[model samples]
Target: MNLSICVLPMHEHLIKVAVVGHPSEGKSSVIATLAERDDIRISARSPETRECHSYDIQVGNQTLLELIDTPGFQRPREACAEFKLYEERIGTDNIAATFLAEHGQDPRFDAERKILTPLAEGAGLIYVVDASRPISKDDRHEVEILRLTGRPRLAVINAKADESTHMDAWYALLNSTFNLVRPFNAHRASFAERMDLLRALGQLEKSWQTDIDAIIAAFQVDWQARMDECAEAILDCIEAIVLLRVAKTCNADDRREKERVAQQVADSYREKCAKRERECHQAIRRAFKHQLFDPAPVTELQHGLLDEETWRLLGLNSRQLRRALMMTGAALGLTADVALAGVSLGVGTGTGAAAGYLMGRYAMQPLSMLRAHTRKDSWLSRSMRREIYLGPARNLQIVFVLLDRALGCAHLARNWTHARRDHESIMVTRPTAATKEWSQVDRDAISRYHVAILKGSSEQVYERRTAVRELLVKLLAS
Candidate 1:
């Protein structure tokens, strides 16, 4: 028997960042948001993180950054007092370890030891503080203790939903102890805010700059890829909905009976299209890495999608839709004016509009092909003379309806913070007004994409999807 082992090269260049602060100051929330992991512990009732825990930011096989979550400082004032005793005796670099040794058995300093051990070992600091509330003596003392460690540090002001009266006080206080101070609301900050924080993190230390830049670059690339995947998912779903067809042989010559049975098959076709659109939404959620069972969001969209409210709330109105179509048509050198009546359509009824109406596009002409084909039902004899084909989705408006739902869902996922743990939903509330007009570029890209998806091959579909993805990423940026 031969024994073989493979040793994976572990990179030592990964930056270690320790997030610390007083209890309930959002130390864990900062880690949860930065790591983008909803599974991490975040509590509203009390402090959650009781010991040191690590979360990694990895790209493919590489780990670019490691965030260490430590227990919040329980005795910051006393810890600082004890650590200061040796500033004149022992060197500044040794005061933290000296405090840990002397207070290891002291019950009050238990949390302090847990927080200081990471900093003593060379991790840069991210001191989280509540900027919404006025700074207390305890907050100041906590910053002083972290400062005594003499490590490169960044102070992060974690503003809760409504705590903003002390932003200036926090900035003025934190600037004295840390290299940089930034006010960030972990629960509601958008993608751009997070990126801005990362950029500031890179400036805390020169040696860690390379790793921080790598982290930022990898994050940006991953986000763009996710948007592209979402676009692809939407396109695939649209194709399935358009090409869906169900047929049965008809024996009776009565036109009424044929239409009735055709309606039943048509219902089945609609059911499948609905299911495909749902899967596409799921795919978009997965692309955004939101795996939590969030039925609230889905239910809200479903109610709106079923009642046809989301189309009115988030999608382009009739005028915008018509204008979009005209713009799309102009890009393709076709002069087509479309009039779309806004109505509350059933699941697969006259759905939403795309570039106004694409009803007569050569690639989208399903009526001629639908009526020309016939399939024999195995249950019926060959004497049947007719086959009724209900659809290949000639109405392009329904595609817009599904696209609206996808966009709505993606928007929620992009802004949602992993720090939240409840059934709280995103995009649940109706917007005060309908969405604004899309830029000519976004509208034109959407129009061109509509054409490619209708007639293009797989490669062409991918190319068009990529074009749309570029615009989506810009929208998601902040």
Candidate 2:
């Protein structure tokens, strides 16, 4: 299909949650467990994803929320030993490296990287350590990394059924490190256990309570404004075409000709709407300074890939490097089209440029930043204020972009359903005035049309314009 790209106004709001941890800590398994829904897909194993993988979890209709799984820190036995010797020579009393060195040769370091990167990205850490093993200094070091991330974190001691003594020590050590601690049997963690984990996440901050509310409010307002502008743009296109159609059909009183004109107008609108959606996606990526949409490796190691010099040069724990690469790849694959389309449509062009300047001046209206700020009342509230201020707004942007795409498509197709059952089919068939209509067809069509415009899909805008042209043609014929 020939696609004509165009710029459409964009709404800004998104939430980004990064899940971090050491390698082999079941980070991927956790994501798979959380995203059992059909819409979500976990990428296949790769060197980078050995630590981090990001998933865009669909929470509701027209919403896409991001969850980034990060790698854990995995220090090799030799590295751990060297680190300990270095620390000892430096007169430091830290023994975490010594403990890790003793256990590093064990298969456990592989799991550590799977857990740590996500934690560092401010995903409320879900530290999962083997309860069957004795509480060691390595676990303590992992906990220290969690603490350093400064995000609200919880420890999940994966209870091994036969080991009660080691579990006790694990619990004690976890309590000393994290504010919340829970025991989970990963092999057989129940749904209730998962809910308990979510509950722990919910209780971490009161910011969760009011933050989403404010974000939703801001998004709704901004989205509505964008929709109105889209409607206006569509209407303009329709009026232009309708006038031309009326002139062509000299029988200005023929109802059939008028209907034909409206159909044509709607078709034009749909095309424009599709283009706009592409533009919005591009704009969002540019705003974040993200070039590739799919995750790509940030660094490469040659010859001695795991050498100490290479590790130090990368500046990331094995898990962090893994997650970063996975995230880069995922970002590249998932949103490459949007990025390319946005650039082509001038979505990233600065206000100094004519096209961009015109858009900012005519399309987007600035709102007060005061309303987006977080309120502080108590000590806990003060501590959570930063998260409250940024998290919801970020999440809102993510939701906005996804919804914009879905709604924009719906408007072009002139139909909206709660499910994606026939979305692909609907997108292929161009609607015309000859199609059977239900009650309030015009209003429904117009509402969906407006939604498409707001979301910035050139295809939908074109479809609506085409329908309007067909309607005008029928009017003129009558």
Candidate 3:
């Protein structure tokens, strides 16, 4: 047998950036946010990274960039003194290489050596500093050491505090030393801010401009794809709720037993709908690369999806609903015919116009008897017993409510950055009345989709569902 070996080609000119800073200055957090890597060990109690670790910013098969998380400088002043001594002996050409050569095995300069090792290997530098605190001599020393390395560097102000009073001083110091300085909130940086930082990185080296542009383009395309996925998940959740039905067989003559069965079906329906909604949110989280962080429902919106407050806050108001009904060709004066599985509901104008307002104002009765079908006893000669259906909800307000909640949750998940490690949940923004802002075109499209779902036409449902998805993608992008 012949032995065959193959070597995979490495990405030529892969941008390597070493993130260096003092302990607890958010070097790891910056990398986590920029790279969207949740596996990076980050803690508030103490510094988590004790050595240099390289993480690739991979887009599919290509590694566009590499972020090197390095240990914080333990003794920058001492390291700066060593640099001066080396510059005098080795003449400033390869200060990083010469210093690492001498201090590579030294126990006292272990962190310094690891932090500077990447610079020795020609990696660009990203020096992180907390702009919230006052500048010190040690910071100056650290900057001096990086400057002597002769590598293109960018200064990042990682302001962890709420009120940063010394931002001016930090910028003044960084401006004189680093090629470019940018303030990045690792825990709160949005996708746009991250992109801005990448553009700043491109400015560091003229040769790296094309590569940086390509990476940014890839990221933009990936973000749009994720948004599209999120839209599909949200629409799927709403569709499941719209098409949901739960039934129970109860003796039609026994009113008490019938009521009990109805209540059970309603509860079950609520839970199923809520579960679908949660699964949608989880899908959105995955789209944003939040595999480890499961955001809890902390706001008022988390109070059960069928809660009275939820309905009131999220569902369309009475006026909006009335207009939407009219737009869908619902006759105002005559007994209004709202489609419910070919079951025509004779809702009067007062009922139709006030439906949304009443639903929002009072508690929502999630399930109602669609119809009772009688079945004859085959084994024994017995009277007809009825099987009661509790759902495929008849109330049109639910469509708007589900739409609002799904859109609001998608917005929250979309904005939730990967760097946030806190247990606090993303607050569901209110008045989650998402449909109230819909253009006439949007409302008309949704109305058609609603009718298509109720009519149970596969072809019409597919066309209408596709239209809704396109609308949702635009909304999510906005």
Candidate 4:
């Protein structure tokens, strides 16, 4: 199912948090990454978020939370110094509110007013900071400013993954200022880690805990559904590839005439396989909620999909193919024996071994084209083109290649936060590991899948595909 169909829960009591921090501290980046909304304006330079913008996080097309991205605190120290004097006038609790009321249009306090307005209007404060940098006077002043507002506040330490020299210091200081503190890297975190942070936000205030609980639950359901759909998409591609075939009638034609027809059919079959695989990949991108685009003309996918280099690199060339065939054959034999109630175990084993040996003989040769010559076309017209059939893409190695590349893309797409606006291609660096995760021992789902692709009923294919899909989902999760 697509995300739009998932009936996720929603609560009327909204959880609104104002993302605030000093300029160039990744304040907008944090919000962008958390919301998984790339449309949010983000920049590393000062004053990126000039006007306050609120992003509504929807579940099942219903708004559950609102994240307000506001201008960074440019004058935190001066504002805090000035507001401190007003503590004696109307007490510290009303200082932020009073400061907003009086200086709403003051150009000098323009950024400060935009940031405090949400906190003044009951939105929780999500103070962001570059924890890699040492704590400064401005950081303390901003923390004090939010503390004086008497509102629920949380701190997110946005530090580089490799930069940890000052993380301990930030944790100690931020724990004193906010209800909860978490360390996060906007660029490299996984989907699970992002959800973990959102869950932490739910615990910041008791007033919104119930509603936030509902949001978290709904979000989890939505994510799980996406993973399931993605897995199904990958298997669906396999099913299509397995079922693809091109047939042509062949008369009592000469060898050259038959070879011409074979070449034509083989070429057409290759094109269809490539096209179908691309369509499946696009479907996967949509299922994962990524903006879908045909990235084939882009060499990464084009080359990796069927390149001979990839086959050799993945070790599916000679040795691995023989190994995979033997495992699949043994599993097939076991399945047949089970079907025969152990009465024909030898029959199953011998037939399966023969088939496996025949397949292994052409381990390094192309299997996309085959000859199934028969005298069935005796009544065919001599005028018609002497035809031969090709495909269902007989190459089993193609499956291994596509699976390896697809898994790599899935891994990257699921982990990539929408905030990233780059065009980095998902690369399949380790093809051997990708296709050989299954062992030869026993009739495991993968071994069964290999057997089914060769000769199994549609129902058998569906069942094995479903199991393989679940395993792929588990891989993504890990």
Candidate number with greatest TM-score: 3
What is the C-alpha lDDT profile of model 2 across 247-346, one tens digit per residue? 1121234556545544444344334433443444343323222232211111111212112332233222233223332332232232322212222343
Candidate 4 residues 1-478, lDDT tens each? Answer: 1123344444466678999888878777787777766667666444678988988876566666788988888888889987887786778775678998878788999999988888888888888898888889888999888888877888988884467888888888889878999877787667777878887888888767766666666767777877787777777787787667776765435667676666676677768877877776676666566663223333245354545555555425455565565666565663433322232225453554454454545534444224432234444644544446554543456566667666666666676666565544433233333666544432146557756876788798778877787788887566
Candidate lDDT values, in order:
0.67, 0.39, 0.74, 0.68
Clashes of 3: 0
**What are the per-residue Cα lDDT tens digits for candidate 3 across 1-478?**
0111122133456889999999889999999888888888888887889988998865555666789999999999999999999888777887999998888799999899998888999999999998988998999999999999989999999899976789888888889999999999998898899999999999999877877777777788788888789878877877787778776676767888877776676677767877887887788778877777654263224666666666667666666665565433332221233322223345444444444333322213332222322333243646445555545554556777777776776676666666678745444434357787788788878877776776647998899989999998988888
lDDT (Cα, tens digit) per residue for candidate 1, span 342-454: 11122233222432344323222222222323345444665655675644543444455556666666766777777766644443553323134566566656666666665
Least well predicted 10-residue stretch by lDDT in candidate 2: 294-303
Arrange candidates, best lDDT first: 3, 4, 1, 2
Return the TM-score for candidate 4, rounded to 2 decimals: 0.83
Candidate 4 — which pairs collide?
A: none
The alpha-carbon lDDT assigned to residue 32 of candidate 3 equals 88
TM-score of each: 0.78, 0.32, 0.87, 0.83
Task: Tell me the deviation in Å of residue 93 in model 2.
Answer: 22
- Cα displacement (angstroms), candidate 1, residue 154, comes to 1.0
Per-residue lDDT for 161 in model 4? 47
Clashes of 2: 137
Sorted by TM-score, highest first, which candidate order results? 3, 4, 1, 2
What clash pairs does model 1 have?
Answer: 132-163, 325-355, 352-397
